[model samples]
Target chain A: MAQLVLSNVYKRYDDGPKGLFRKRKVHDYAVNNLSFTCEDGEFIGILGPSGCGKSTTLRMIAGLEEITEGDMYIGDIRINELPPKDRNIGLAFEDYALYPPLSVYENLAFNMRAKKIPEDKIQEAVSYVAPLLKVDDLLDMKPPALSGGQKQRVNIARAIVRRPGLLLLDEPLSHLDGKMRQTLRQEIKRMHHEIKCTTIIVTHDQMEAMSLADRIVIMKDGVLQQMGTPLEVYDDPANEFVAGFIGEPPMNLLPATIVGAGDGFEFAFEGSPLRVAVPEKYNPVVENNMQVTLGVRPVDVLIQPGTEGSGAVPVAVYENLGDERRISVRIGDTLLNTTTAEDVSYHHGQIVRLSFHAERTHLFDPKTGNRIRSNVEWR
Target chain B: MAKIELDGVTKRYGKNTALDNVSLTVEDNEFLVLFGPAGAGKTTLLKTIAGVEFPQKGLVKIGGEIVNHVEPMHRNVSMVFENYALYPHMSVYDNIASPMRSKLYKKDEAYIRETVERVTKMMKIDHLWERKPSQLSNGQRQRVAIGRCLVREPNVFLMDEPLAHLDAKLRHFMRSELKEMQSSFNTTTIYVTHDYMEAMSLADRIAVLNHGKIEQLGTSQEMYYTPCNEFVATLFGEPEINLFPAEVVAENGRLYLSALGQEGLPLEEDVCQALVHREDRSYDVGIRGNDVRFSFEHRPGWMAGTVYANEPIGNKVIMTVDVEGTHIRLVAPNDTRAGLDQPVYLSLNMKNAILFDSVDKSYVIRSDAQRFTQTAAAAGR
Candidate 1:
């Protein structure tokens, strides 16, 4: 296990129609100036939306795509120019490309045999990894005979059997069903624990990235927005995109007119005609009647309207999610959402008061969406 | 609004039964969801309701009247698939207006455009009306599909994962929008999805299907709190529910199951009954990670387990605790001080436990003797 690094990486493609054999260079900058490090035994996730150059970065690391510019290193090695086989990485992708003709056991052993490993070592390795990954019984089954989840497990086992210093999984859970995905997620987490390999996975799914990685690398349009542990990302999101992206039933962003200054102030929202108290930290930045974006998560936004606090907009629509009912309120033009205690039934268009926590509220610069300085205390 | 029904519906492709004797009712204006994993016949059920697929041995009814052998158009149902199936060449306005094109529709142009404009504004896509599908984003294209559906003023709306193609941000935005719109339209809707989040957050009631059969149906809370069996116990939530094998121990005057993993945790009446058997056998105990709590102290009702891993997700931490021979997840709050591989006590949440029989794997939670006796007396009287 070692620290993997990428420095100022870049990619460009040629696009043109000037001559029969001529082309014009188009600078796409797919991984422009991207730099990050995954430490020894660290499990980091590369997360972003579609077309965000995450896959391109992973491919570049795998030696499948040439690094257009800059240096790449695994541990102390300047391994950008090294072949994939020499780099020593266990890799898995969304699609499992297994040999249909080979049985699971044979497939696990084939990679080692190609390297001319002794039959005893191959069997030992297979036996060691098979039961840990819950694929011990599936060893004799061919690819066609196994279910999708089984095949994925075998694919992962194939990638990790050699005990590579690093592991790269690209959306490995994307192809399975919801239930199967959850089950495999537990198995993968368990596998990562027992064998502490430095892992880096690329995914567009925030839930996967948040749940699996020790720290997450968030990318957008080839630019790094933020990199931190999942707690750091979700609690103190760098901006609107990160805040909106991380949570289910995402944080409710209310466009507000910052009313007063001081530790205890009020924010009057436009459209929704609602107001909430702001903690002292936003005092200097908030100006009376100036537009600012107020961020409150469904969890932090509380009901119990009569609890001697600023109230929320009345409820208009409620979604009963069993665990929680996400209710929407119409306050002027804005819609505010808060998760009520499960089994609290409310009718549509019912008016209810909501109050945002002074400590839990977040403020962002309306135009840029960057997290503004605030006194809202958090973990 | 319409009441849609399926009776003895069975469809087969070669030897596989996509839908097997599935019968259900969708009351007028109800937001009903047919939710399941892929190939569990969710789409097939939706198609059958829309007259898209002919069921070999059943009748589909609209407004309590059988619509067997009826053409799709005559059935007056609108369908939306994952692709949206919008016409690429047609602008959003024309696409919305296309449903009205069967007749000359020249005189009805004003009415058509009005209704299109109404639904367009309602779906928040009025500005993109003149743009072709190629120019619009996936979310915008979906709105266009919904606009076309609304223009028809059909009594039934069948949506098959209409929001599957959008990004996370847009999906959340649209999830709420679809919920609000579906309620406002009062259209009898049959929504199909493989996403539990969507099913939980969007539906008035969810019908969980497995192997082409309705395993359970209820309000989202009922499904979450009282899953009919083991399959549902594990299927309905994120990070998944934890199923741990437990042994039954009958003590003096009460039923006490062995929970050595988290010692002294009170085994609720239901959990004790789930473990009850004439043969004194072991059984499975199903509890959601969110409901299970872990403590450092060896409280009387807690079991000791090793923390296998910690999965962080901002608000909560999912800790997989290994107890005995099985590993179960317990959603720890973010601020919990437990470290990885630390020996900890997992206190079973008695309030949320849904117990099942080990052999049959069915719901068999035992109620309190008092409640049972009361029900028995009431039945006798």
Candidate 2:
């Protein structure tokens, strides 16, 4: 097992004005100045939108893409120029990428034999992996005979058979259905726990990143938007994008106008006014009458009712979520989603007060997604 | 103003029966969802309801009137597919206005523009009116498709997993939006999807289908807490309802389960009497992980288990606990540092337990079990 690091990683395609297509730089940077480290035996996720260069970063680590200018290291070895085979990295792409002609057993043993590992060790490796991946009975079968999950499991087992220093997975669960994806997700996590190999997976899914990774690196437009543990990214996002990207109904990103913001934070939208206790940290940088994006997670947004003094917005829209009911209400341009963990029903368009926990609040710059400088981060 | 009714609906193509003997009634203004796994007749049923496909042996009625022979266009039902199916060359305005134009609305161009404006504002796509389909995001395109469907204020709507193509985050947002849109119109919509979350979050009631048959149809709460059978019990919940090898026992003039994990549970005599009187001893006791409490130390009523794995889900965690050689999930509150093989006790909250008949495998709620199984056998002890 090994820890990997990339500093100031850059990937520029040969298109447009410069390389691939024309004189116009289609993308100034596929990946730019990206830096993060995956500790030994830790699983880190690369999360971003499709064009945000998550794949490029993974490809760079796999030596499939060349880094324009960066320092890359795996454990103590700097493998900037090493061939992929010499890097001793195991990779599993979204397509499974299994050799169709070779049987499951032969495919797994191919890499081991190529590396000149002993035949006894090869046999021992297959025996050990087949049972864990639940593919022991399909050793002699070809990829054509295996189901999607089985194929992916076999592919995963094949990737880990060599016992590479790191495991790289690229959207391995994208092709599977919901239930199968979830089962396989658990299987992969269990596999990681059992093998204890430092792993890096790239995906555009926030749920996948939150569920599987010890830490998540969120990228956008080739820039590192945020990098932190999932909880850190969820609770205290570094930017508006990160805050909006993490949770469901997404952190309600509403444009807020700073009213009287000296000691207490005074907020008013449309016909409603709300007073928020300013975290002493943000109070310093948050000027009065400054424009900021006020964000709150749906789970934290409380439903205040029947209070005449600015407690609730008068609108209830019904959402039947299995055992619970979620009510969506509009406060000016922002929508608040309140969930009741019960089977009760609520009339739509009924006005209800919404009060947010000030401590769980987030403020971001309107122009840049960067979190508003505040006293909270220093704490 | 339409209540859809199906009687013995069966559609056969060659050797396959897409829909079989399906009889159902969708009340007027009711939001009915058709849910099933792939090839389980969810789409086929929707198509049949839309009058695009003919049923071989059943009558389909809309608004208290049978419309099995109605043409696709005359049924007043608009179908939206998983793909937005918008014209690429036309702007969103033209795409939305196409349905109205096809229906031969002879209102002046001003009325046409006014109608387009109303739907555009409602869908929040007013700013993207000039953009063509190729220039829009998947979500934007979907809004246009819905806008097109809503142009004439159609009485009944059919959406076939319209949000399936988007990413997870976008899909969540769109589900809420779609539900809001459906209720706002009050058009008595029939939505179809393979996603449990979508079905739960959006539908007024869900029709669970399997192999051309309706497993059950009820409100989301009914479907989750009170599933009628093994398939329904296992299909709806997440971390899945933990099924354990439990047997019924009677002691101290009370009903209890003689299980190994916990010393014993004060069995709900209703569920047990139902199971045991049915002469079913080898039964799988169904319990939700959320209802199961985990403790660091073993208690008398708590079952002993080893922590198998913990799956952190941001605010919460799903702990897979192994009890007596079987892996059962335990939904634990987040901010926990419980690790592998950590010894713990899983307490079964008998109040929420659902007992299944090991033989024939049907859920036997209190009264029904007693009625059917009184003479079958003695309550196992």
Candidate 3:
């Protein structure tokens, strides 16, 4: 096991010269100054959209890519100049690049053979790890004969046969179908526990990161957005991007302006008369007539039958989605989506009262897209 | 818009049977989703409907007209490829307007420009009209492809994973937009994808395919609540439905389902009556992760187990429990937490439990248990 730490890491690529006598210009940073630490035996996920430099960060840690600047430490030793072979990292990518000519057992032992480990020790290691990964019965089968899930299992087994200190998986479940992906996800969690190896997984799927990683590092355009436990990040996101990115159906980010109501502040919808009061705790930082973005998850929106007051909005689209019913209402040109239980039915064009859970609602500074926090204790 | 009908459609490429005796119907203006895993003939079926591939057997009909022998250009169906097949040299405006300018539907310049403008505005690509295909992003290119299809008043729209290449957030946004577009245009569409979420939210009905056969076809609710086989049940949910082999044991005068080495779970009166006369005793018990309840304390009907892994997803937590040798996943609240190997009690909501024939993997008894329970309660009241 190893504790990995990255401090102010940077990666930059230079564009080639276009014309004669013209110097090559340095492009934008592929990975900006990013810093984080993964404790020993802790599983962390690097999550981002494409082109966010998540893969670049992983390559740097694996010693595949040279860091442009800053220090990376494994335990107490800095490994800036170490070769990839010396990093002691196991890697499994989306493609299960297994040797088709060899049996599962041979595939698991290939790395040990390359490292010149004794046959007896290799046999011992394979015997111990194969059963843990539930591949004992599959040792004699070739990769070509195995199912997609089985091939992935053998691939992971091969990576761990060397007993590396760190395990890095890059979108391992991206190619599997939905059912197989769920099954393999559980197996990965179980394997981590049994092996107790420090692991880092890179994936664009938020659900995969939330279910498997102990902590998640969200990135965008080479910049670190937020790093926290899934619960912490989900319950209280750092900004509008994180809020909208973390949840399914995404969060509804409606433009609104803060207005004075009674003794507190309220958010008035930009294009409509709908208004929701800001929680008392946030009233200190919010001001009247301040333009802000109101963020609310679909699950937090309350929809009631019939028009009760000015808060009612007419439904534009209503869909029956198995266990839940999704209702979309058009507020000006923007459509706000809300989810309810399947039993709760609302016809399209029906008037429905909408309310927000004040505690669950979020307010953001529209200019910077950052959450508006009070000076007091606000997480 | 035209209704599409396929009767006993079968397609084969040498030794491989791409589609075998598949039959389905898409109603006029209905959004029908063809969903399955790779190698499930989803794309081939779409091509068959578009007259790109002729089935070896059976009939393809569009608006009561047989289209198996019709040329692809004369089918009046606009097909969108997974890869946005756009002309690199032409500007976005010309690419969208080309469909309206085709010889089959050539119109006056005023009519062509009006149609192109309406579709470009609807697809949110009005500002990118001057850019070529190479200058647009993947999402923008996809919108343009859809716009080309929408520009012409096509009878049927065939989309083969048009949004597969977009990022996750963009894909989610595009799904809702596609559904809204379908409804507003009132075009009969046959969309194809392997993503379950897209099938669930976007489709008026989904036809689940496996090995070129139609496993099941119904509305999303009907498919989720009353799946006819193991294949259909497994394709629908996250955390996947837990299925375990069990046996019905007649104890005294009651029938119980014994599974995972746990004490027998007494079957409901209606379920017991339904299964009492069957000679085969073995069955496959199906339960959704959301329906399985977990508690710290043991109750009479609860099965004792050990928590193997507790995974906290955003809205809910999925806990995998080991009962004897079998592992079953159950969904819990977001705040729920448990240590590995911690003792827990598991209770299944029998009302939602389904049973299947263990050997052939066919549904022996659908979940009429909920209906039976509700009816019994109403009578008692």
Chain B TM-score in each of the candidates: 0.86, 0.88, 0.88
Worst window of 10 by summed lDDT in candidate 3 chain B: B372-381
> Each model's interface RMSD (Å)?
2.6, 2.4, 2.0
Instruction: Give the alpha carbon lDDT tens digit for every residue of A192-305 in model 3.
Output: 988889999999999899989999999998889999999888988999889988977688899988889556787777667776677787777877788988899888888888
* Greater-lDDT candidate between 1 and 3: 3
After superposing candidate 1 on the true structure, give the runs of residues whose Cα lies further than 4 Å from its correct spot.
A13-27, A99-106, A109-112, A117-128, A136-144, A259-266, A306-312, A331-334, A340-343, A375-379, B85-98, B104-144, B244-252, B256-284, B337-340, B365-381
Model 1, position B80: C-alpha lDDT score: 84
The Cα error of candidate 2 at residue A185, in Å, is 2.4
Report the number of the highest-DockQ candidate. Answer: 3
The models' CA-based lDDT, in order, is: 0.78, 0.79, 0.85
lDDT of 2 by residue, A1-379 (tens): 9999998888888533544554434267898789998899999999998899999999999999888878899988888899998998999988988899999999889888997999999999999888777788999999999899999998889989888899999999999877678778878887888889999999988888887898999999898988898778888788888888887557778777776645776665654454444455577777778888888777677675554555655653677665346777766644566655554555666756667776788888889877876754665
Better of 1 and 2 by TM-score: 2
| Least accurate 10 contiguous residues by lDDT in model 2 chain A | A15-24
DockQ of the candidate models in sequence:
0.46, 0.46, 0.51
Docking class of 1: acceptable
The most accurate candidate by TM-score is 2
Error of 1 at A44 (Å): 1.9
- Per-residue lDDT of A66 in model 3: 93
DockQ score of the complex predicted as candidate 3: 0.51
Q: Which 10 residues in a row give candidate 3 chain A its minimum summed lDDT? A: A18-27
Model 3, B360: alpha-carbon shift in Å? 2.6
